[model samples]
Each structure stands twice: as C-alpha cells, then as structure tokens.
Target: TIFLDEIGELTNSAQVKLLRILETKEFFRVGGTTPLISDFRLIAATNRDLKESVLNGKFRADLYFRIAGTSIYIPPLRERPKDIPVLAYKFMMELAQSKGVSFGGFSDDALSLMMAYHWPGNVRELKNFVEKALLLSEGRVIRARDISSYFEEHSEFGRSLPTKFDSSVPSQLIFDNLQKIWEELKAIKMKLSEIETEKKLSSGSETLNIEETEKKLITSALEKTKGNKVQAAKFLGFSTKTLYRKMKKYGLR
Candidate 1:
C-alpha cells in the first residue's frame, strides 16, 4: 500500500503518471523497458477541496475518481475539543522523551484554555505551542500559568475586552453580530456531535461522548481552582449554579 499526503498538490504531469499506474497496475523502471506489474492499494489525503479543484480544472476529474475510493472527513481541532487533551499528552510525551524528561501531562486549567481557544492553525500549531510550553515549564506538569503567556503572545484569547461601549453603533447591529457568532459556535458544536455519533457507529466505541468530555473538563477546572468553585465556574464561562449542577451530575467533589 502507498500513502500520498497532500495529493491535491500533485502537478498535471505527476497526476498523469499516477493515474496510469493506478489504471494499469504496472509501471516501468526509470531506465528499464520491462513493464513491472504489482498490486497495491492507494490512499490519498489532501487538505484542499478536491471536488472544487476538479470543478475549477485544477485537478483531473478522471484521476480524482480513480483515487477516491473512500473518503473520511476529520473535523478540525477546535471542533473536536475533547481530543485536545489526548493529543496534547501524545505530543508532550514524545517531546519529553527527546528531552530526557518526565511527562507530567497538562493541568486542568491549561487543558481548559486549550479546548476553549479556536486553533486557527490546527494541530500543527497546537504541537508547536505544546513544545514551547514544555520547554518553558519549570516542572513536570504544564500548568495554566506556564503556557498562558505563550497563548497571549500568539493569540487574542486573553486580550482585554472593550472598556467602553460604542454608543454610535446601533444596538440592533451589535445584537446581530452577537447572534452570528452564536450561530457559528452552534454549528461547530453540531459538527462535533455528528462526528461523535459517526465514530461510535463505525468503531463501536464510546470514546467521544461530549457529556463525558464535559464532565472531565469540569473536574479539571475545579482541580485547577483549588476548590474555589466560584473561580472555576467563572473561568469555565459557566454560571455558579450550572457548575454546581454539573458537579452533582458527574459526582464530582
């Protein structure tokens, strides 16, 4: 089997050669005349929208069909916030091994901040940020304090809110802007829910339960705040009452 990452970037000439190989299941050596026949499976991945590329004449329609045997859509990191901790740990451990250090994992508040942020650069950005955090960390565990500066430096997450409301701007316009942001958040959440359902059906594993993930987040927040439920709830963007209710539901202390 052969795996081609970013196959959408293939040039026209390269695509022609690949298509021929797929069609005939044979190819000649660089300088040999004998045709070499071998059976192999092809798996191609691309971040680009291949269908749109095909319509725009950027990718060949016949080549697209030949390689597109099965397609799986993996949502971006921000949409699947539950996967953040897992991937963070994976990256942290790998980095720690290379540095000859122990992997202490991420503190709850740190993980919470990560889950809340919209990763514009996706997993690669997350990995790079994790490396920075690990390097600057004074201890084994990566606490919120350890990486908070990096987040602020690289993103607008912890930036100050507007001190004064703009009276000149119409209230309705402000409301409409808020509504659009809310709708976008809702859409992302819906996509995550759909992906969770698909994962359960295909893998027969209940690994992506949003409720379970929420429970873990709440537990982490509480731990980070050191039993200050009010602060934890505030940090989590939840009302104290809601936080209490979730703690009760999850049998959290």
Candidate 2:
C-alpha cells in the first residue's frame, strides 16, 4: 500500500503528475525519459475536506476522484467520548509493555479528566500524553498528576479558577456545582465498571502458560516494530541472542 498523508497539501503540478500516473499506471523519473509502470494500491488521507478543496479550486477534481476511491470518516476523540477510556488503556498497555513497566492503568480521576477535555489535537496528542505520563508515573496507575501537566500546558480546560469565591454566592450556583459534581461521580463509576469488565475479560477463564505468554509478547513486539527483531528484543528488554533463541524455540523463525 502506498499511503500519502496530507494529500491536500500537494501542489497543483504534483497533483497533475499524480493524476497522469493514476490514469496511465506509469510514471517518469525526474530528468529521465523512460516511463516506469507502477502497480500499487493508493491510500490517501487528509484532515482537510477534499470536496471543499476541489470546489475552492485548491485541489484538482480529477485527482481527488482518483484518490478518493474509498473514504472513511473518523470522528474526533471528543465526539466519541466512550472511546477515550478504551484507547487510553490500549496505549497504556502497549507503552507499558514496550517500556518494560507494569502499569495497572489510569486512575478514575485521570480518565475522567481525559474524557472531559476536548482533544483538539486528537489521538496523536493523547498518545504523546500517555507516553509522557508513562515516563513520569511513579506508581502502577497513572494519576491525574501524571496527565495534568500536558493539559495545563496545552489546553484551556486545565486552567484554574479564581482563588476565592464570594461568601454570599447564590444557592442556585451552589446547587449547580453540586449537580455537576454528582454527574461526574456517576460517570466515574460507570467508567470504573467498564474497566473492571475489560480486566476480567482480558484475564480470561484460564491463564496461558508462561511460554505461551512469552511467545505472544514477543510476537506482539515484533509486529509493533515492523518485524525488526533487534528493536523488538530491545523493547522486550532481551538481548539479541536471547530473542533469537526464544524465536527459534517458538518456531517464529
């Protein structure tokens, strides 16, 4: 697969060239007359709306039609609130394992803060935050302290309120604050229940044998590093020789 990110950023000349290649299934190297036939599936992605770009005359219509053979629209993180905790745990697990740390996962308050915040930077920002938190975390679970730094530095949601409130604050204001607190608590409880269910399901009825778990982890590390055994070995905290031995034992060679 040939993946072109930010397809909308391509220049008009580049777009025309791409269109020609897509039409003729061939391309020419710079300063070379020979046309080279290319046979590969194309997958292009862009945050910009290609249709709008085409209408605005910023993107080539024919090129857009050729590249957008199939399109998938993925909503931003804040739009799909339920996925926050799921993706958080997934990143936590993958990162923790790769770093050779044993993380139990995020605290309820930490997860709540993440869910409440509007992720303008989306999943990439969330992944960076998780990785940073993993490095800074001092315990099994990632608490609000580990995550607050990123939000405070980058998001308005992390700003603090005034130090003091009026002593004569209205009763309605107090009631509203209480109601919001109650709702947050309820949401936390629901998230906790979901995490518990996930943990139980992941643990399964019967635990895998040590060898099985080891092989699985090795395979996962290999896949994550795109079959780079040395990187996978380092990720698993094993020497290259030890990794090779394990792979041979598991018939992974």
Query: Model-by-model lDDT, in order?
Result: 0.72, 0.71
Off by over 4 Å in 1: 31-33, 156-253
Return the TM-score for each candidate structure.
0.57, 0.61
Writing each residue's lDDT as its tens digit, candidate 2 over 1-253 gives 7999888999999899888988899988889899899898998888789999999999999898888778999876776555677676557656755776544457768977887777777788888888877777742467787778777776774333222334797969876865664454344334434444555588852322335445656776687679999998876667999899999999996
Question: 76 in model 2: Cα distance from truth in Å?
Answer: 1.0
C-alpha lDDT of candidate 2 relative to the true structure: 0.71
Q: 1-253, model 1: which lDDT tens digit per residue?
A: 9999889999999999999999999999999999999899988888789999999999999999887888998776766665676677657645755665433456667877887777767788999988878776633457788777766776774233222344897979877865663443344334445555675799976445445545655666677679899988875567999889989998998
- The 10-residue segment of model 1 with minimum total lDDT is 157-166
Cα displacement (angstroms), candidate 2, residue 251, comes to 13
Best by TM-score: 2
Which regions of candidate 2 are displaced past 4 Å? Answer: 157-253
